[model samples]
Target: MIEDQLTEDDVLLPTYGPRPVTFTSGAGSWLTATDGGRYLDFLCGLAVTGLGHAHPVVTQAVADQAARLTHTSNLFGTRPVLELADRLRRTLGWDDGRAFFCNSGAEANEAALKLARRHGKHADPQKVHVVALDKGFHGRLMGALKLTGNPAKHAPFEPLGTWATHVPADDPDAIAAAVDDRTCAVWLEVVQGEGGVRPLSEEVLAAARAACDDHDALLVVDEVQTGVGRLGEWYGWQTTTVEPDVVCLAKGLANGLPIGAIVARGVAAKAFQLGDHATTFGGGPVVCAAANAVLDTIESDGLLAHTRAMGSRLAAGLEALAADSPLVTGQRGRGLLRAMTLSGDFAPAVADAALRHHLVVNAVAPDAVRLAPPLNVTPDEVDEALSRLRAAVADVASPTGASPTGASPTGAAPAETDGR
Candidate 1:
């Protein structure tokens, strides 16, 4: 177990509240803890490791690039970056598109917001405000944080520099009412991953598109968590008929490597001039090479089709489980990105129980559990995850079970209830 007893604060910043279990290694759909126990990794690095941990092709590409060239910065061009950019254009179906690379999802969204503001300023100086959906998450950076719709996350860092407004999601009328002449862009997520895995309905998506068109405002879609086949497509926007002017992507872009990108088109593409936006380690050779390998592997191995099939199977299983258990109310989201709504705030307890059963899942909300397993997760592995989840649910729903909220299990089945 490495035998180190030092607390997190002793050596690291107090930015994250990580779990106590330390994993030593991972491969495919499983992770081995430092204590030599293996667990099914459904979290997949918070949807970054879509190809699974330590993927062979990505690992080889990283190794080769490290031996050849690691970083040349934005001062000089690199072949890997150029090739990867070209591939992204084709994959994303952007004919007249431009790409800006960064190190994280927030950076990508920040660049998009900046580009939209610049585009608006170029048209008219009064167009400075941007609109985002309620419950939408952009990033933690200043510009991105201002664009985020969550009030609690923004309350602490008051007086955000950017002039942005938040509107209710799935309501076109609300979007139309909020977006005016001063609005430069409308930020949206096809699926709200952080906000209980809510997917935008087709009518609501159409409303956002129509409103942007009517206002001459840029439609900026954030695909940070739902992009790269997580939603059974290359990009979440591709699932619907609406088109966005700016698309932000990150997370699974490089299969766990730190990479983020913004793809802009038409006026938005021309908004940024030389020195308007740049980054030091945005598209270095190593990460770009890793990203290229990810794209190639996804296409060559047909992970997209696999993701759709597996996602359907997983959703069916979840639906059946919910039908059998009163504790579970319903399910939402698309493809591999799915969530189960609990009757009470038992998500943390269920997650803890799953951990004890040697499985990894995330409590995305107080009453919601999200699942974003690897795209290549085998059917057998998914079956195993379902089994573990059932056991975890049973353990938490037992009559004598310990509840995280210190409340009795109101939805618990009778003592003789059989497994669903």
Candidate 2:
């Protein structure tokens, strides 16, 4: 008799490759695999769980809200959803801001895309074109995918429409030239998460802002990966000189919960009227309550200041690693969102090595290893991650075992403390 085998390919679609490890549970900055082995979580599930896994506050909020009400659809009002919208507006510092809730970054971008088109069609109908930067990644939905600048992701699904024009990320003049009377919005990411963790030049950002002003177009910032204190700020755009009319947020808003929101101010706020767009589970009470808990924890515990301090420590550690290693070129990016730039395109191998050493990180680009730990990450945790990363580097860059390192390949015991 043949064995009854169950595999990821047997029941699930192969959108992602086969998994190597199965996690049983997680707490702040640490994950436990099925084998009872512990791993240091540096990627934070693609920078989504800024507050880390199983946060007490968020867990409690979810329990309370679920006990009271799970969902009521968008037709009815919920206190958590209403309070969440007001809280988001307060964080954005846009008193006149309006929000549309959704399920993911892609949906947030989709809603913004439709709103931009609505705003444009209201004016002349010909002003529907969008200007976006190359290497920018908004989302994977149809309209959002078109706004995304990478041609590789778009190649699989062609006929994405020619509404958007992509230009070089650092070229300010080209961005200025791309916006014309036909443009309705200029899409950009302050820090390109999937495009090699590159930060846009202030000149390019300023040019986009200026061009939008001149053409009467909306400046929509994709804050999906950079929002909710990932960059040591409320939003990445807040650290830049240019102010945007609309910003799409997701990822860290509700930690691991599926939540997305777009906050629009000024004329952009009025672009979408009642019934312009809607979602069933977007503003559900449970998720909104979870998001409120996330906000409350960040504010009450002062994660912003803690993230800044820890970011500095992490940055300094990476710099020290680069200085001592021959393979690493240096580091780029700011705050907690950082990349270890390598001299060669061996980021995948490095990431694999990191995984083998029980560290969770990923290759944001061919030559960059992205490290985005939790916002309230402790100093000891940061040091421990650096140690593991160094060991990973030693294993890859120095296969002969000549490299000097501090951490053990067998995985050292993590610090006992869990939260900030």
Candidate 3:
């Protein structure tokens, strides 16, 4: 049971409607709550913990870096940060690219937007417009939020600059129609995570690239959720033929540590000269050290291949579960970032039922339940999750409208789209 002390004192932020359970620690693909119960974690901190919880390599990197050097600010150089940047550039095969680091996915996107604007200014001062996809999420800061397409999130902050134009994903014509000479940049996710785990078609991504090229606009790919082997690639766009001028990554960069990066290629990289942009906490020693370890382990352990195999296994399991259920409509996504759609908006109920079975899952949208398990999740773990999910679906699909225990069904709507 949850302690009532916090409610009485009101010490925590009201932003989150947190569950009663408090996690004490985690290892591999499991988390232990304060009450001593272990649960399989499929959410993976919204796709941040790619290597899994308490990964030995990451833990050791953090400890060793903390003992060596933690922070020295952007005013000075750090070896780990430079090494990590070089490794990223080499791994992505973008030799002409430059990197700008930050503390979270949002900041990384903000920097990318800033770079786009600055790049445009160099060509034409009037080119300040940005184009993004509907149902696509970037980040939360003012600039990043402006690129986000969900109206519910932007409505409250109306009167936001009209610098951004929104278009539907996978609509090449719509994307082309939105871009013109005045547009500075076009932003999109290879797979829309918060927006129901929808993957953009190859033709659509190719069209966006052509449109950007035609109008001389920079293409920005938001890889916050899909980068670092989540999509079975170092960067999500690698799976596609399209090459973005700028890419933003974060979520799994440090395997749960806070780190974000904006990688720019060719002229886009030269757009930001000295004094154009900087972040004090960007690429701090400790986080960079952790990121280095993440990259090393990912390569050394062949987690990329593991992620691909496990993702297919997990997706097959989800399909099997949906095959016999009326509630599940379909499954979508690539690699580990997958979602199961329901016939109706029963995502929240399904999540609750999964919790009851000691599994952690999240409903990305009203009718979509997203699963971004750790890239290293084992086949046995995937099998267990499928079993729990099968039971959850059955429990939610029961006609009695009550759990087996005769309790009222919890009716909370699925959590909002991560404020995409």
Best candidate according to lDDT: 2
| Candidate number with the higher lDDT (1 or 2) | 2
Give the alpha-carbon lDDT of every model.
Answer: 0.86, 0.88, 0.87
Could you tell me every candidate's TM-score relative to the true structure? 0.95, 0.94, 0.95
Taking all chains together, the TM-score of candidate 3 against the true structure is 0.95
Instruction: List CA RMSD, all candidates.
Output: 4.3, 5.8, 2.7
Model 1: ten consecutive residues of lowest lDDT: 411-420
TM-score of decoy 2: 0.94
Q: Which pairs clash in model 2? A: none
Candidate 3: regions farther than 4 A off: 1-4, 7-9, 400-420
Name the candidate, 2 or 3, with the larger TM-score value: 3
Per-residue lDDT for 204-251 in model 3, tens only? 898899999999999999999999999898889998999999999999
Which residue pairs in model 3 clash with each other?
A: none
Q: Please, what are the lDDT tens digits per residue for candidate 1 over residues 290-360?
A: 99999999899998889989999888888888998888887888889998778877777777778889989
Clashes of 1: 0
Q: Write the per-residue lDDT of candidate 2 for residues 227-302, one digit (tens) a residue.
A: 8888888899988988999999999999999999999999999998778899988988999999999999998999
Task: Give the C-alpha lDDT of model 2.
Answer: 0.88
Model 2 / residue 394 / CA error / Å: 0.7
